[model samples]
Target: MKKLNFTSITKYTILFLIALLLTVTAIVFLEGRKSKNISLWITPASYFNEGWYYFDSDSRRQEIDSLPVRIPADKFGTARIYHKMVRSSHYCMYIDYYAHHQAVKAFFNDELIFEYAPPSNPGWLKSYRSFHNLIAIPLNRDGILCIETKASISSTAGEFGQIRIGSRDELLNRIVSERLPQFLLGAVLIVLGFILFIITAFYLRVAFDRTILYFTLLLIFLGVWQTEESRLLQFFIGFQALHWFFEYMMQPFILILSFLFIKELFINKKHPALIILFACITLSIFTQLILQITGIAQMTSTLFMINSMFIVVFAYILVLINLNFEFARKSVKVIFSISIALCIVSFIISSAVKHHKNFTDPILYLGIVFLFISISIFVIQKTQKQFNAVRSAEIYKKLAFLDISTGVSNQTAWYTLIENFSADGIKLDKYCMFMFDMNNLKTINDQYGHLEGDKAIRSFCECLKRAVGKSGDIYRIGGDEFICLCKNIDYTRATQIENMFDYYVKNQTESKVQFTAAHGYAFFSPSSKADFIQAQSMADKAMYENKILSKKGRS
Candidate 1:
């Protein structure tokens, strides 16, 4: 048997464990804080989940052990749920429940109290389909509470949610408070998405990848969907139609954005399966919209079809992951795979347990949060890697043209500038070139050491740079030899610069060794029509003459 190596696997396992621990810690901390806040002000409401009986339109009654019991898919007609309410001393008692795509009528002691039957139009029916119902119940009167629900479409049939009884204020508070964490989470995602959008637009545009843009969009849509699903917005907006429209419309977009994000994450490879998936989803969304507009079918009725499409999407993602397993980064592969698995499991569970519809699915929320976190990590890592690459390239380019020893443009940069000037057909008369050779550098090196020689050379270069400032460019072409190219300078300005350079060299006191340089400048005459090489020769010749004169004066 051959021995197997698990070194890479072990390393990634450790990383995944650490990441998981941190994520769990953060969730626990947030939940703990929420729990503490809830305890402070929220009063728990009594849920009437059991001891109920349901009757169909045919007058056939069936025993319901719990409040939330799914009616048969085939059953579509008027239905009634009867539960005896306990007499309460509270002056204002209220019963709250959620009705999905069903017209509701509430009665107490065979007397009608509340009705929510909307117009028969499909559009009107869709707008009123799903909502939180809060009915004021009479207090100090013992009577049977009858909730009559009617569902015309079979898809919307049999879905009932938990009923709660409490004071009106208490029940309202409970409803909002229960979904507050989810609402806030969604709001945070939306805010974060917009912030990322602004940053990418203004600051990171050059270095940003489309992957991050897609991720930002995913966050925004996901937040919108989550917030809408929480149904807390209905309380404030007071427009069930608008909320319902957004609730259904945002789903396909969220799915599309997710796919786009994943596609970009895989280096934008256009897989055939992915293309087909995109086309299919797009077609389905448009078809659903058309059906909704024509009143032929409602978006809610086609949810199973959408759910099936997503199942295909998740399956395709798994297949794609497997195909790219060897090439994907360890962190990305592990984190993304785990998150997708969690999301798929949660989605399946949420779909399977349809009867329990009191609050937004927390497990699905966790999976989504985890997936977003994983995407954030991947995108940030990729952006950081690209940033490092760009920074390194810039540093390399700068170092290529810089003289590390003298803090000046090096010989390579001088040649490059000359090439550029020649390529652009620059006239020699537009610029003046100066040649400089440091005096007594050999003697300084022989007497004081090479370090002293280097100091002298640097001192001379600094004097030249300060005198020239922004008006000219300086290059250290060789040891103790420098060149200055000044463009668009007149004779008077050139003289002033030369005088300044001499003054700076004379007054220099930073080094123990005296720093002096012999420099010669030549203005290119238009009459001579000289090339740069000839002009450089003229400057070099003048520099030698200046050196000889300086030596004679010293003697």
Candidate 2:
């Protein structure tokens, strides 16, 4: 109702937290009532014993959530397990283990289904003793799938293990867990971002802090890319090609966000590194696209490795910039660190799952939450900093032009305005100027003290300011003298303004501090080399004539 009121960091933080809480609640509510026809089961490390039958545990373990097993260096041995499948259509089994070679044999209710060896390189921390297995076992009826693992007899000084299992819809769930929530979160951010854009567009006309507005928009685009990649939405919506396209396409958004975020946060205007980074991102995307289309394994491998390394390197660069800029406060830094950590964790989980089967990780959504909060903190801090800087500048500017006592333009500011007019040259062909000297200010000060005389001067200035409207500038050039310059105006407007001031002063019945003002007008050509002093002299003479007339009237 109050248009978000994001003037303070606290208000913006509160809004972000509320939005996050609402999103989580909605996701949970949406997931709670689902009735999808898919087999759901958990496969822990010790699911079978003695290679004969499968068993269910009475208790659940924390490590069983996504099947991250730790195998010690000494206990290197083989394990045989028999798993009975109740009913199978199109089924997938995912196994994540910390081993090199875990040979698997599958059996279906006394009949052998298949026997195969898990890939030697499951792509889990390459050269480390970690492997993941995804086996798809299709069948027409309910049967038993036995898994007998034979450890490498020649293994020396390292852990050898592999996770083995088989199920229906495990692949879909794994893929969904990796990409769905992230995609949806991205869509939400994009929509909300445009809404913020609309608000910013409206405020920019009157707003002094343009930096905050620009950085906020950059963060919104970052949110979009994080969502698209994390949710694998490209794959779901656009097929395999879409997935491949997104893998490269998402790179540009990341590069752009990093460059813009760092630039805005640090106030760096001419950093060539940012341009280079964008070009690199563009090149990488093109290379990746070509590699995916042509299916060049060598090129693909080289590019993937390079991209992954760049991610780590660029993230480190961001950290360096964050440290150097000091743009983020302590609270903001903590939030950013946590979010970055979660993002790294999400990437690790996604990469690990791509090699394994059955086990699914829920880190994508968690990472989304962290990234959003981090970006929110950065954005809020940046906005507040910029707003404070601009407001301080405005305050200084106001002080520069204003007379402290009279609350009107001072001599210094009057000269500054004249200089500006000098730069532009005179455009108007006709104008009015008025110069006034308060009558007997020295006598008034001696009789009634300086304070009373000062009050009279301030009152006159206030009246002149009110009567001047938008056509004139009022300047207190001296203690007793003031000048009012009105451009693109004639004697008629000046007379009207003078008459209004005189009427207001006459109607005041409380005070007897009588005041009088004199004014002058001229119609000089733009080509004439008339300085402000010449105009002031003409106005001063005209004022003297008016004053003599007033004195004669009083006599």
Candidate 3:
């Protein structure tokens, strides 16, 4: 029967217990805070979507059956949307909507109430993509609500989104809840990126792979871009410029970093196609920034071009992967290819939805998340492979230098240690060399068996190890002989170790085989190979003399 390793079992048991305790605690905390009344927590808002009238720039009025009245893309001018307000007594009534690439003014009963991005501003200043608006309705009054909108961009003229009316707090809560997942996911990715960056930097000496750094950067940029896309930050910081800058700036770098990350998985580091793509994307980013800064063009105006570049690069990467399929790692070939393909499909879908509905879609973000997961899998696989290789190398190294029977350093290790010291010209200052010879090993083997002799040898080694402790290294140089080398030890310490060895050998009771050994030690300060050999010879001679004396006493 095999003996059980109680120490390992106990260690695992403790870890499992700790994990269970933490899980239970978390469950209890979550259950305690869980809300029972879901309806009360989430108040449904009413949509003021139907029965609206729209008047175009040509003074032509049209009765719209529903909200989100879309004007012609070729038309670039002011438009008016009219709807009758219904006062609600049960809630603090407010109307909330989104304005996209347009300036908006709200009037209640011919009185100006709320306005954003007045027509007096320059075209550049009014070029913000989207902003949310909330207007409170006066109590005890019923009047017609008119929203006047102006769009300088022809593509976005007269685009009105869904208008919702409800309690102010409920509407705000609903909006936040809708965007919270994307915001949290982005924040989590950013935090995870920072954590990975710190870990890679801390273990930079041991970790040779640069892919982790690239992947971390990619995560951070993806996070920033996703958060910006969520529009949750707009609620906290009203400045649209900051959000626009990050959203556009992070997109280009995300592409570059993703390319670099994929590039690292391949055997060939420098692929011409990838380099060209990288340079082109970088140039486009710089050009966009310069144009936007100079007021020659807005970043929003060039968004379609950037998105087109993304599609081109994504498709090109698929082709590139096909061309270099044989060069990439197996993990990369399967995971990266599928992830990129899925991302491309999702990007197309998301673009279509955004173009159709004039609103942000979550499909692209989901695809990005999937891509991140795949990249993480690839990195983990690579790291695991490297770890296994290093572990195998270390195991092989230990086997080469270890004695099978005695579990001590073998003769080869001793020779190697001496050669290393000699080659490095290291002086053995105040070093003690102890030699040990087992007694009655041949008698035991001849009378009982070699198995008993092996047991005796192991027993002798165990006692020697106990005596030596951490002060010296023990080596099994021969079948019945051993050597212990101690650094920075004097004659007095050598005598103490010798006494300890005898005491341990006499008191050893684990093995049924009777075991004894004769040992002798010599001090030396050798600076050369010859000097080390002379010192070893002296210790051996002293061990032989002690062996003979021990035999005579037994006689």
Q: Which candidate is the best by TM-score?
A: 3
Question: In order, what is each prediction's RMSD in angstroms?
Answer: 10.5, 13.4, 7.8
Predicted candidate 2 versus true structure: per-residue lDDT over 1-555, tens digit per residue: 555454776877989999999999999879977966455533322332223332224232222222233222224444434444556454544443223444545555766555655344323311111123345554556766555555533232222233434342444455455456667777777776676666545653226344445445655765555554564453446343343334444455555555555555444556576556556666766665465445443232434543453455346544744666465457657667767767766655645564343343355456546555655666566556655776788889999988999888899998787566632455545656777766677887888888888887877777777778788888999997888877777667878888876776556433357666555444443343356767777878877887788779879
Q: What's each prediction's TM-score?
A: 0.67, 0.57, 0.68
lDDT of 2 at 223: 59
Clashes of each: 1, 6, 0
| Candidate 3: clashing residue pairs, number | 0
The TM-score that candidate 3 achieves is 0.68
- What is the lDDT of every predicted structure here? 0.76, 0.57, 0.77
**Candidate 3 lDDT by residue in tens digits, 220-246:** 988888787777888788766676567
Arranged by TM-score, best first = 3, 1, 2
* Best first by lDDT, ranked: 3, 1, 2
Model 2 clash pairs are 92-167, 94-357, 94-358, 99-161, 107-146, 179-231
- Compared with the true structure, model 1 gives a TM-score of 0.67
The best candidate in terms of lDDT: 3
